[model samples]
Structures are given as structure tokens and as C-alpha cells.
Target: MLKVIFLAAFAVGTVLADGELIILNNPGSVHFEGSQATNQSFLKEVFTVVLGYTPKLTQPWDGVEIRDPFLLPEALVSIVIEGVESVKSPRGKHFPLNVDEVEEVTWQAVSRRLEERDTNNTLVRIRVGDGLDALGQSALGELKPNSVDPASLKHLSLNNEEDQKFIEELQLLRAIAQKIPSTVTANSKPDVYWFVVSGLRPVMDLHGKDSEATKEALKLLNDAVNDLSNAFTDIYNGQVVVALFTNDANKLRNTRSVESPRVRREEKAGELETFDAAAQNSSDNLNTIEKSIQKLATDTEGLVEQIVDALETTTQDSEKSTTESDLEERKDDIDSMHSSENDYDPGKPITLRLSKRYSANYPVIFNIFLWFGIVFFFSLLAICIAIAGMDPGRDSIIYRMTSNRMKKDN
Candidate 1:
């Protein structure tokens, strides 16, 4: 009777295996100098839960496989596999993944409870994850969503002695990526999943673009690129990509053939050196552009304050303030300032936050300037009058002009 009960329970457990699980890890195009063990460990942990099986550790660069064989010792009996492939997509034509063709794959158990599903019945979906390091995650969490404060950028510029715009951009990219769903479900089915990782970094330089600042930007960008590349080495299952661009002639010259090209470019002589030169020039240009952008941002902020005050003042003016047409125009101006709102999207190429929440502040400096100018002008006029009164020739003219005798003499 005890043996019969044991057999019945074993049969029940096998029947209860209701769903299939898959875990995948793919390497991106660019390889990092260091980063192997961490990625393997991450993959092992992810698969251990997803697939009810222990992984056979091997070199990630070569390839590893797990099988769903029935003869294997039934110690939880789940299979896990890892593969590398080149994923082709029309959307990201110039993406690093598109160029490198390195991807990882695995299969895991859906959950501890369900086991009926198998690899044949389930559609496997795969994607990359935009892995954020501790610093990256911390930085992103601190930033406001869809809230690109121009003031914040100015503050960053002033505080960051290194002038690390690339780092700032990286933070921005993380915020943008976070808005999108992390996992992709195959055919809208819950059983299958794909995870993705998109890397963000700085592009190189161009021809005739040699300067110290550009060189520094290039160095900073390269450092980020290298750091990110190394970070991905440990995340074995998700696709990894390095984001590089050639938006301008100079950028093209710098990155033409250096590595992954995110932008279209024409081949030039000494592309590597051209890129190096462009990277150097980019620093100076960036400083100039940053200053200009800061000034514009400040002016816009001031304008916003003035508009808000005007609106409040008119609101209080009950009957004697601005007209309906003028108020409407003011509203229109405010709306126009955020015209970029009409073009916000997650998948769009240019992700710029043109519409942002603004605050109103007292115009202390402006008011002080106005009051001081008025008072100084009046004081100067009084001094001139006093000087004229003390002058004998000028005093006679003024005194006689007001006198009854002076009128008779005239």
C-alpha cells in the first residue's frame, strides 16, 4: 500500500509539469576587455529559476547547451541552453548588434508549479536589456521622468569640472529606455519572453576637427564605451550593443571605421586620425554650444517667469488688464515654447524633452536694476539743478525769468 502511494505521487508530479521556461543570453557586437565570469554567473542564476535544471558551465565565447533528455538523473529534470546568434532587424540598421551578430540563448522552466509546456509548444522570444551599473541606476532614479530641466543641465555644466556631456546624455538615455517595456512577449503570449540591452555612448571626431576640448570629449566617450563594454561581459544571456554615431562630417571622420557606426558617413582619408582630430575639436565646440544653450535656457526661464507674473497680474486686474486677444496670444506663446511636445515618442530617433515643467521666481536683479537706474537719474538731475543755482550767470537768468521786474524788462 505504501509503495502504491509513492508511485501515485510520482505520477502526479510528472503530470503537473504544465509549462516550459526559456532563458537566453547573447553577446553583442563589441567585446569588452574584461567581463566573463559575472555574465556567466548572472545567466546561471536566471536560468536556475527559469528552467528547473542545473547548467553545465563552459566558456561563453565558445557555446554551452542544456538538453531535455529523459534518461538524465531526475534531480528536478529541467533543461537550460545558451546560444549566440546575429539578430537582424530593419529598425536598427546601424545598431552595434546588427554589425556584431553576437547573441546568447537559454530555456528555463516557467515556474516551479507548472511543467506541461515544452520547447516545441512554446515560441521563444529574445531581446537585449539596457544594463545599468550601480552608478547608472542611481543616477537615473534621481532624475525626474520626462523632466529635462534646462536649469539642471546648466547646473551640471557648472558643477562638472570635467564637462562630461556624454555622461549626462547616458543618464538621459537610461531615463528614455526605462519608459519602454523591458521584456518582449512572443505573439503577445505570456509563456515566451525576450530581454534586450541597448548601450549608450559617445561618438568620435571628424576631419579638420583637432582641438583640446574635442580630444577630452573623445577620451570621456571612449572611457564610457569601454566601461559599458566591460559591464556587458557578465550579462551572458541578453544582447549587448554599443551605441556610436556619426551625425556630422566631423563625427564620420572620427568614427568612420573605428567600430560601430550609428550614423551615415562618407569614407575619408586617415579616418582614424580624422576622428582623433574631430574628437579634439569637439571639446571647444561643445563648450561654446553649452554656454549658448545655457544662456538660451536662462532667457527662456526668465521669459516663463515674466509670462506667469503677467498672467497673474492680469488675473488680478479684474477689469483694466490685458484683453482676451492678448491673453490668448500669451497662452499661444507658452504653448509654442513647448512645440516639441507634438513630437514625443519612445521609438522616435530624436528624443528631446522640449516641453518641461517650469517654475516662477522673483526678478530681484531686474527689479533692482530698474529702481537703481531711476533713482540715479533723478539724483543726477537734482545735482545739475543745484550746480546751476550756485552759478551766478545761470542763477540770474532763472531768478529774473520768474520776477515781475524781469517780465516788464523783457
Candidate 2:
């Protein structure tokens, strides 16, 4: 089965599996190198179960931490573009289109340019970016959408990372839907699964430390997140599992650590102290056992005396004399027991007894087979006898073949 590519915002590199794994990594947090991109990050378990692989994330072109890409049994294509900003609004429209526009165009180019080794191969494109504090919530009237086209996200100068991302994802999903044919042909092209990850680095870059700007970005980013959520729901309606995870480290740059309420457990002495006391008491038991050993020794001496007395009593009870008559009476018994007629002497050779021999009876099925064979033989003999009594007609083919008159006539 053709599988979809996963899009996850990776400050470094990440192991994301299946088209269903859509990770919105590092929305408004740090970029370039962050926790979300690590091998042990939030997406690790996600990759392990869904991607049918153990996650081993690494920095692009770095030798040290790269795991899954090298260890995975299947072949995978890895693409990395260095020093590319996810979203940045230029001064007074530097060229023509904005970041979102370029991203959409890039999708088209990637789809068309990657010449498939198999003509039926459909390309799956993944786009990843960080969110701007989150995204602008359009419903709250915080930010207005410029247009429904791809430019809608780009023109926002307000780079709501998720808005731009959702717009892009929606566009790609539609494209893939269009590429799919209603009636499956003998040779059908694989539908493309476009993955998108959007981040709010643009909002940070555009307006730094401005409270008003930050507030504006929050509104826009909120909307974008909602849009992304709605998009996920739409995708999930087709029976796809959509999961959302907030990375612990990516939530903020710096914050004071709060004292954990569970600290009391750590401070208290462990229940192991009771076990230790019991162990000490067990060691003390050796001394008590040693004290009892003296008493046990006395009991042992008494037991030995009783055993000796029992032996002497039995010896006295068995004291008796054998008579010459008794010997003579036993002589006959002894002779009978060792009689040569019995063939039980040590000088005699050993003999082995033979068991009876018998053949196995035929099974019921075999008996039936035997009866069938007899009936068949008799039936054939009767048929032969009946044929032998028949006279063939002169017009019959058998008579014509056997007659010399036919040859002569011919």
C-alpha cells in the first residue's frame, strides 16, 4: 500500500511515520535546535507505533545522533534545505508573493519535478513550520482572512503560522482528492498525501517584544490553530487518527521552576527502614539460637541413652538356643529350596520366554474395499460371459470390420 508522508516541525531532524502523523512541533517556542526535534522528544513514541519503526532522530548532516534513517530496513528519501526561514514578510512586497505563496508553489514544483521511477507513483509532499505563539482565531474577529486562495495566508503580513499551514494543507488535500479518479482504472496513480508543519517564527521576527504586536500575533495564531484543528477533524472523518501533543520544552523559553507538591514523599524516610529493623532483629536471632544449643545438647545425650537401652532390651529378648532337631527339620526345607530340579541354581544358564505372535486385523474400510473388488471382478466376468453369447449383425461395424467379404467387395 502507498503510504502518506508525515510533516513535523523539526528544528533539527525527526522520525515521523505514516501520513496520519501530523505533528505541529514548536509552535511559538525556540527554533533551530529544540526538544521537539530530539530522538527522545514527544514524537518518539508516536514514530515508534505509527511509523512501524523505532525513532532515532538526528541533526541533518550530523554523524552522531542519526538513528532510524540508517537502521530502518526500508529505503527512504531525506531532503533538507539549510538556512530557509519558514515565514518572513518582506518590506513592501519585495518581489511579488509572500512566504505562504512560495510554499504553495514549492508544493507544485515538488509534485511535478520528482520524476517517478514508477509512472503510477504519486508523490507525497510534507511542509513543516513553527506557529506564531499559536495562531490567529478568525472567529474572535482578531484577524481577518485576506482571501480563500493560497495567498490568504501570505497576505496576512500577520504570519499566523498555523493559518498559513492549514491553508497549505487544505490546498494539497484538495489537489490530492482531484488527482484521485472516481472509477479505478487498470493502472491507477497513487494519490498524494501532503503533510504540513507551520511555526510562528515569522511573528517573532516581524515584531519583537512589542506587547501590541504579540497580542495581535496571539489572535491570528489562535485562529490558525483552530483552522488546523478543523482541518485535522476533516481528515480524521475519513477514518484517520489525528493526534495533538504539546511539547514540554517548546512551550516557553524560560520560566521559574515551581516546587512540586510531591516533594514531601521524597523528604520523608522510606518504609524500607522498617525492613532494615526486621533484618537487624533477624541477625539478633543467631545469639538466641546459640543459647538454646546447650539445652539441645542435653536432650541429645538423653536420646542416645534411650537408644542404647532399647538395643540391650531387644538383645535380651532374642537370647535363645538352637536344638539339633530344629536343624534337622530345617535341613529338608533347605534342600527343597535349593533343589536342582527347579533349575534356579547359579550354574544354570538364563532363559528368555517368547510372547505369542499375531497379525493385525483389517480395518472396516479395507473390508469394504475388499468386498467392492470382489463385486467388481464378478460383474466384469458376467459382462464378459454375456458378450460372448451375443451374435453381431452383418450391418454392425464390428461385423463389417471382422468380415473378409467387405475387403473383397471394396
In terms of TM-score, which candidate is strongest? 2
lDDT for predicted candidate 2 compared with the true structure:
0.37
Show model 1 residue runs off by greater than 4 Å: 1-167, 170-208, 237-239, 249-410
Root-mean-square deviation of every model: 36.4, 22.3
Residues 148-227, candidate 2: write the lDDT tens digits: 54333333442555345544433333332332332212122223334443334434454563445544444454344445
Clashes of each: 46, 22
Q: Tens-digit lDDT track for model 1 on 167-250?
A: 454443344334323322122111322232222112122211254444444443344333433333232223322222211222
Candidate-wise lDDT, in order: 0.37, 0.37
Candidate 2 error regions (>4 Å):
1-237, 250-275, 281-298, 313-410
